[model samples]
Target chain A: MTVPSRILVVDDDADIRTLLGEYLRRHGFQAEGACDGASMRERLHRAEFDLVVLDLTLPLEDGLDVCRDLRTRSDVPVIMLTARGAPIDRSVGLEIGADDYVAKPFEPRELLARIRAVLRRTTGKASAVRPEATRHIRFAAWTFDPTARHIVNAAGVIVALSGSEFRLLRAFLEHPRQVLSRDRLLALTSGSDVDAFDRSIDLQVSRLRQKLRDDAKAPLLIKTIRSEGYMLACHVTEPA
Target chain B: MTVRVFVILVLGILFAIAGTLHATAIFHGPPFRPTLQLSVLGICTLSLAFITARMVTRPLRGLAGAATRLGRDIDAAPLPVTGPTEVKDASMAFNAMQRRIRANVSERTGMLAAITHDLQTPVTRLRLRVEKVEDDDLRARLIGDLASMSDMIRDGLEWARSIDVAEPFGRLDLDALLDSVCSDAQDAGHDVVLREESAAIVLGSVSALRRCFTNVIDNAVAYGGRADVSCVVDGARAIVRVRDSGPGLSDHQLGSVFDPFYRVEASRSRATGGTGLGLTITRNIVVRHGGTVSLRNRAEGGLEVTLDLPLAGAE
Candidate 1:
């Protein structure tokens, strides 16, 4: 038997609270609702939740304050709902420890995906998969650091990787020397973007190879196993 | 300013005539030497008057140029309050009015934010409720229609907030930014290629520029079958051209493409979830960065959108 995840939906709108609760329940999760920060605190006292869907604007107490309080008190995953596509609100939401953000008029499916991703991130040690805490991954005389969002080459020059490149490289390091299929790489690296197996992975790999100084004509590091998938043809280790 | 130029020219002519008469009378009727000296004096005075008039018109031209520059980017450095007191006062007043205009626009954006903020809750509620529609096709259609409506309203809010750029300017690598955007578009299954990379440095709002390029590139991929993006450092401007191999816009329809909510056809973008606000927001952000964006139908086949953004030292 498997235990269903408990989700708390916090919004001033009663209709949203009810709809989210019903929707999550229909999807085989234990769901509950709270109108504002006070009722949310009461619910927290009575039970534990696996995640929180928090709205940024609220009555009496703002959602940021509630999130701050939740961060100090517990480790519940928080997904912020922002009003517009304002970059500032997204930054502030992340800076204040919200795990992820979704803009208004969002597809429920999108939010559901974010919730699952956040849950996977938070439910450590309980699952078979490992967490992404490794700071520096070394491979083929190069230092790939996820925290710094850069990679250091053999000549000790730091090269910045784009967001997608960093995610794709990290996916490679997680399973080195294994011929991972395009589908697997897409699943591992997919976020809001790159939701499918596309030529983007091939292009990203080529660009990453160029940065790593891997020979594109006869690649030594990331090799393409034709008719199969791609493999990081190198020994990867964590550098202290 | 033209009126001032006309007044200065009239004054210069009057001064020239008056000086000629004065020189003639001062020398009286001396035959050779006096006449030669008076001619020299008269010519010198007229030239002096003409040069002074030119000097007066110079700052006026500066003011006009400053106005045009300020129109493009509100954050551009204000007109230096030099020159005559009247000019100084005008420059100072213009700067103050620019600040007021900026504040007023931002205030309007703030209000739009408030109203849109209230709207999201209901929209979210309605979307969630639509999941219980029972009929598979009905549920999907309701969800899709609701999602489009939400996107449209969100675009409305984003359109209002477009003028409000709260991001700070930073030293951005142009090549890297373009590469990232094209890569993202390519990842989303678009045929986007970064053909050329001419790296340049620019002081601009990173987020705003990113959104600007993404919007343009997205339009290319959506409308054009494929997108070929390139960057070049042409003097002080970083020129970015995004060309797509799709059916280009007709000449008559091109002028209205950037208008808010203006769609070439009702069904074209609606199916793709485009709110028709992408170009509007892109234009607002590019103009905020002292850039000009233009679109033209390429004779070879598709649409080509070019953006020329001023570099840090260009202006």
Candidate 2:
């Protein structure tokens, strides 16, 4: 009764456009292809898409320009296809409101996984996963300041979190006491593209656990729920 | 008028007036007053010349000093454009020339960055395609080759970044920085020891300078078995030496070792993997901080990498 989530792929390469479109369709998702900014605009005007897989390099109009324009006009979630690996370019994409990015010549499956993750985060459903309008999250002796995107330990020293690591930890903090299945975490961390089995989630969880130092003293922080999934076994509280 | 000509003309006029007054005094008054008048004229001319010479040379000396500095340091502070209009114009032109040179250099660096960026798409594509190969051994080999290729390209790009150094400078502790780097190397199974006892404050882009020291210690431990790092302060500069016990480079290799990707592996072991740009980028970062990086072979069969950075107070 309900149409599947629609994704728009905007790329200049025709082979990539067709191949990627077919790949997404075979995976049971609807996809539309656009060559440049004008066609992308027409597609958006015709119907709303769940997410946009935008390439930073285009024929006529620059991808970043289109992304910046898209941010001002619509609330559509965008995942940038960047060829440059420079951190400055990545920061610029994030600054212009791109939800995520995948370097070009990327595996089509990787792109699909990212699209799904971005959609899950952008669609209204994600608000329930990430508490809305909260500034601070506290668990154990660590304080999570989402605005600064930094974690401070008991000594009040900041701990560095790689991008995926932060996303995984934040997901756990948000879904405290609830066992999060690998598939759910895969969607949460967007680390499921090449990971066929449970490689990504298991690796990310163990990494997060290590950073959290979840041991006998902090035993209940993150617990392996046997064959079920992973659970942040502690209470997640917000500063009043 | 030129300062010299003006001084001469003023002196001439004053002497003419003084001669006329003395003549009038001698002709109209006592003969005994002539000596006093001559002495007065002598003192006036001598004092006037001394003051005028100093006034003319002071600002000119400043301009000359600034010109030589501008020749050596492209980013030297502009000559104060606040003197006479002619001097102001000259200083302003010099400042403009510095700005133009800086802009030109940055533009070239940007072009290099853009070209290096072109390598990424194909590299990423190859990596993905390699992952799909059915042969396990072949796939693993191709992936490893691709990764090294990627690292090499990244080193080229990092070299460009070091040249630009867009990050703002910050004051950092030399001791803590070395401690962290040594700890990281040790964690990675490299035998690196840091003398954390010595403390020096330096102004630099923390990440850039950290990358420099990391590269040095990495090269040391990779070629040599262990790395011993020590920091010392000497006058206006802080010196850090990373010494390793590995086989040192020969006389010929030492000369070109810091050349991008220049490797001494021809005579030494081939186990180490590097894009060759490590030393190149390290040197660029150190030079940007008004520092120097030098490599020398230790008599005990190893290499010593020494870096000298200007202290914050010195800067």
Residues A143-163, model 2: lDDT tens digits? 875533346667644444444
Per-candidate TM-scores read 0.77, 0.62
Q: Which runs of model 1 end up more than 4 angstroms from their true locations?
A: A125-163, A169-188, A192-195, A198-240, B1-32, B36-40, B47-51, B75-114, B266-269, B311-315
Q: What's the distance in Å from true for residue B35, model 1? A: 3.9
For residue B283, give model 1's deviation from the true position in Å: 1.8
Q: What TM-score describes the B chain of model 2? A: 0.77
Model 2's CAPRI class is incorrect
Off by over 4 Å in 2: A1-10, A15-54, A58-79, A83-86, A95-125, A128-240, B1-73, B80-100, B126-149, B170-203, B225-241, B249-275, B298-301, B308-315
Interface RMSD list for the candidates? 4.2, 7.1
lDDT of 1 by residue, B177-252 (tens): 7776776676667788988767676767655677788888888877787889998988889999999998898887
Each model's lDDT:
0.76, 0.74
Docking class of 1: acceptable
